[model samples]
Target: MKNLVYIAFLLTFTFGFSQKKTESLKIQNNENAKVHFSDGPALFFTNSDSLILQVHPQAMLIDSLWMNKLIKSPLYDKEQYMLGDDEILVAGLEELPTDLLKARLKYLNSKTPFKIEYNPQLEQVIRTYLQKRKSSLSTIMERARYFFPMFEEHLAKYNIPMELKYLAVIESALNPNARSRVGATGLWQFMYQTGKYYDLEVSSYIDERSDPYRATEAACMYLESLYKMYGDWSMALAAYNSGPGNVSKAIRRSGGSTNYWNIRKYLPNETAAYVPAFYATLYIFEYAKEHNIKSKERAISYYATDTVQVKRQLTFAQINETLNVDIEVLKFLNPQYKLEIIPYIKNKNYILTLPIKDIGNFVSNERLIYAYADLEDTKVEKPLLELIKLDDKITHKVKRGEYLGKIAAKHGVAESNLKKWNNLKSTKLQVGQKLVVYPKNTNPIVTAKVTPIKEDKDETTYYIVKLGDSLWSIAKKFTNVSVQNIKEWNNIWSVNSLKPGIKLKILNLLNDQKK
Candidate 1:
């Protein structure tokens, strides 16, 4: 009887200790896990082991007891939650379905450098991320191959770490045309002013911020400068995403801890997670094969073209005409030309990228291409000169956000003139719509006097107003009298209307006035 009682007591005490230890382990695991909210999804990280994620509340209980046992194994590394090859020991486990077991094994054997460790606290975060993004590890991997090469090249040129290429993936999924709601544009999402500083020109006809090559070059220069300042790739990437000023301030606030991990707490919430997200993306891309993620089929390949220097201005229309190439094909190859016109100055040259097959054709027709471009320029010049000659009589294309008053002010004509020119009853004008204005005539006035001409006296001429003449319009016609002076001389109350074919007085008019 005494032997039996002692045996029972020993068993109970052992069970209690095991239970207490398991509970303690669970608590420790929860404390180490930190939850992060991202734009697409929430991420959870565990300090004690690899990350464990749940896509929903139901997923929380998904093989929970089995995962708990796996977390305690020696094969799992605490910081990375990576499982060594030999760590598959589980006892007293029920045989799961084949598909379920396969998934579990795949997750466990993932070779990605970044992984979420299994734990209760991380379960909610995982669920949130999965629910919000509806994205899987496979999808992210599939899209990476398309953009990674261009990013790698640019990063290399800047001498930045190849790992930083993942930052572009996070900022924009290699989409060259990505634009943010805040007017941030391009793959790197640079604002207008920032782009200008980096020599990415934005004009009425072209926005270089949308050009992949130029924007990438600008991004590389900016990143290189940031790296020079911080002497750390991670910090440099952080600064690139969220300005150097912010990163500098964050470092200052963190008691001079230049390390991203150390100063992460002081950085903006988005930036704090940005570094980790980049790392996670890198891990996903590098180890995609191990995760059974395959690359998606892309219609276009990046290495199919080579660049050539064009020393003369060339329009896409001209290229199409001379080279017999499609405009879309040209656009695909040379996306940097925003206006579809390479404005190559005398000393400046544009690097025109063309396909390997098309290079010979482009070279063959180079002169014809130049002539075509010159012809186009000449055509543009003629119209402008004609419009100038017509002065206030010509129509103007309404730009975006332009009103009748604004257009009138721009052309140095009254709003009424613009309205009358366009026959517009209202001030509203749609973008690209035309508005007519009689340009200010600048002709020198000649006054006809009935006085007898003395010897050595100059003969004066008087100009008669035509059927369509206003002070502004008349000033524009002559190129002599300014619109202001035209108004002053005529003493017109409102420059809205002027009767044409009226004689105006002028003195000492030269014969070379027509030229």
Candidate 2:
């Protein structure tokens, strides 16, 4: 009897300890994952891992959870779904009956210019959203309440189909500041060159691509142009994801087929999934009531907000204090103002947007607010840097042993931009090929002959982390340096470790560090 009692006590103690440990681990992980930076403006990372299916020049990498779910489903082997070499797979887990889905899709097809007829792939995408991403649909719907109106206004002006607003839903999951891994940014995921071409200005102090109104207008115009090129909305969407060149190639490869489904095998894998994802988002949002997806309550709407012109330079910090507006609300309203400072250059008036109630307060006390902002500016230790406007284009002639990376680095431009500007299909460059470049920096470093420095493998240097420094940006400052290399060298895996003034160890590189 004593032995039994002792064993019971031991088991209870062990179980209690295990339970506490598990709870402790959960709390610790949650804390680590949500480490907030209070020192400066918070960097809002996109809700991308859950939603966006990247469709860029490179092969698409999707969320592993979605991929795994598809792999386990019987729909994975369906011939009707053209699974790409890079695995364009998504299957709904028997959540909704096929007949019901087909009927709904038929309704949707009749309503939109897009060819949204029922297919196994389309059904899989819709079911996947209904099953796995149903919870997120509520939040997405709430955001749509704020953004869709603006999207619709512009779409109507351009005479584009109103349902085309759903494209933004999948492109960004309704996050205005969503940035893809390849540097495609904003709600529509516009590449730097594409954004520039659309006259969406990207300056140090402002990225108009993140501006809801401007970005929406740009998207409508671009979509309108694409529609003109390909007489089909589906084909236009395919061109939007993979460039028209790729779409044209696909059509040619598919024996002059203009239909998207006919050329699905020839198109990029990501483009194949892109149209279906958009359709899935449209279906979920359209039939949210049937799916029992409830929208979360949103306090603010685009209509409720109004803009006031700033007479002088104003910082969000100053405005937050003086107007008693939340800094986050100001950030949300004026996303174009990077670094949260509205510059007051002569003849270049930058507007400050605020809630309708706050607009009256701002306009009434404009002088006092400017006085307060001026006083605050005087108290600052460092004056904000002047915005570098990218206005000039320079031609770079490719020399022997020269590649896109080498040329781009020499001119201080992105390789993607170089490719886009020159319309080069691939990274390969022939000798004497001239590339037009809109350099971010007016003065690019001229390559100079360097003295060779013998270095030990153990020798390392430290980099002082700046306010806006990211691991990716830091890696780009050195020759042949990669983010992975920096991660391993500094033993710093988390972005939380990258606070200002933190010194990161970098290995010595050939040709020293980039100027």
Candidate 3:
């Protein structure tokens, strides 16, 4: 099978070669750390001897033939970022002469901290990407033109290596909505706790992790943080893929070798491939033209879109209904809003990114769009903490032997509520994960007959009214607090005259019930 050959080719190149029974090469600290062997182990290798290995292009090419006997999933089609997730084919690639490959790699001045080795394994991945995955590579290239400017800006802002921009391609194939099987989401594949640390809010209607611009910025910050922790980009990347704790353990296991290659064997299997994949991707992208790869036509140019702040809560349905803009494109442009609805709070800001041509239509008919229907009136899901205990604030630091269900029971809350409050897609918990608990309470009005929605007696929420927000709509958020209560709180006798940007304080308790 194609997979079998592919595995053989990779293993042969990456982890092959029998150790010589007598006087085999073994690598030691610093003296000959970079010595790479082609036929045997680098046991007892010292700086006094040569560390370079010469590989015949024809030999590798012949081996590549067996790996390309059959074509499997064009990895790009399934999900672009799943590296080594499918068959690798080099059958149709315009072969790069060994001398020319060495020449080109040397000629291309790369400015990354990670070592870009030109080995059979790296070449295998590059050739596979350029040949079998050419279509996907082209697509990624086209989209990169649209996304890279932002990536560069953020990378520069954080003083990170500009070459690190390719990380997004390897993380999510530039797809903002791309999610990993491990529940890491977005271009950077941030887990829920990591995303929360970066301040990417996830609610019923919005998930900022899928926002291209915001997520890129968060990724930059996170990468910079990792770099600070490890002081080496290669190790930082490894830590980024598999946490710093794992990398530290690997270092300890590798006898305290600071060099990534020396400690590479101790890293997780996937993580060992991670750095190589990144390097391979960087090489392919940098010399795409040399490999006869051309980027496909892009949907929009870098400046084709514009972002506008939404003064009020609005949905894709409402926007499409009024402005005639395709909601699908809106979703594509703004993938962060989980429900295609952007929530608006008076003191906070939310934006909708759309094509420049559509911005005019949106701005012109903003009022009609927000006031289009009663869709926003429906109750949206709140954070888990807000749905559980009635307290205003509670922090639960994960302890040993604690699970979500157990934690929920201890707090007298539902397990599902815990996940939502934490924006966790799974129940896996670390020993020290800090969870915020927003206590939920039912505050049914003690009225004669009409029982409205329940509220938390100890809590208060605020809202800002735009052209479309109304007393009736705002009242829906509370159990018994109605339009009368809103009018009384703000001293406003009329509803239609609500001014945009005016803050309204909402108390949770019904007036009579409180009394």
Best by lDDT: 2
Task: Please state the error at residue 241 of candidate 2 in Å.
Answer: 1.0
Instruction: Report, for every candidate in turn, its global Cα lDDT versus the true structure.
Output: 0.50, 0.65, 0.62
Better of 2 and 3 by lDDT: 2
Write the candidate numbers in order of decreasing lDDT. Answer: 2, 3, 1
**lDDT assessment of candidate 3:** 0.62
**Model 1 lDDT per residue over 139-231, tens place:** 333334434666777877776666666666667555455556577776677898999999988774356776777888888888778877877
What's each prediction's TM-score? Answer: 0.47, 0.58, 0.57
Deviation from native of the Cα of residue 177 in model 1, angstroms: 3.5
Model 2 C-alpha lDDT per residue in residues 1-515, reported as the tens digit of each score: 32354456547645755434221100011112222111222111222221111111111112222222322222212122222345444554555788888888899888888888888878777776676565556666766776787788899899999999988877777766666668777788899999999899888778888888888999999999999999999999999998999999999999999999999889888898888777887888888888889865433666656777787888775675444454446666787876667888888757888866467556665654565455444433333334333446777888987766557656555454566677664455778988888664332222222234464656677789754345644664565565546655665533334455888887775546755
Better of 1 and 2 by lDDT: 2
Candidate 3, superposed: residue stretches over 4 Å from native? 1-81, 85-94, 373-515
Instruction: Give the runs in model 2 whose Cα sits over 4 Å from its true position.
Output: 1-95, 381-515
TM-score of predicted model 3? 0.57
Which of the two candidates, 1 or 3, achieves a greater TM-score against the reference? Answer: 3
Q: Which sequence of candidate numbers ranks them by TM-score, best first?
A: 2, 3, 1
Off by over 4 Å in 1: 1-147, 196-211, 290-295, 374-515
> Of the candidates numbered 1 and 3, which has the greater lDDT value?
3
Weakest 10 consecutive residues of candidate 1 by summed lDDT: 21-30
Error of 3 at 158 (Å): 1.2
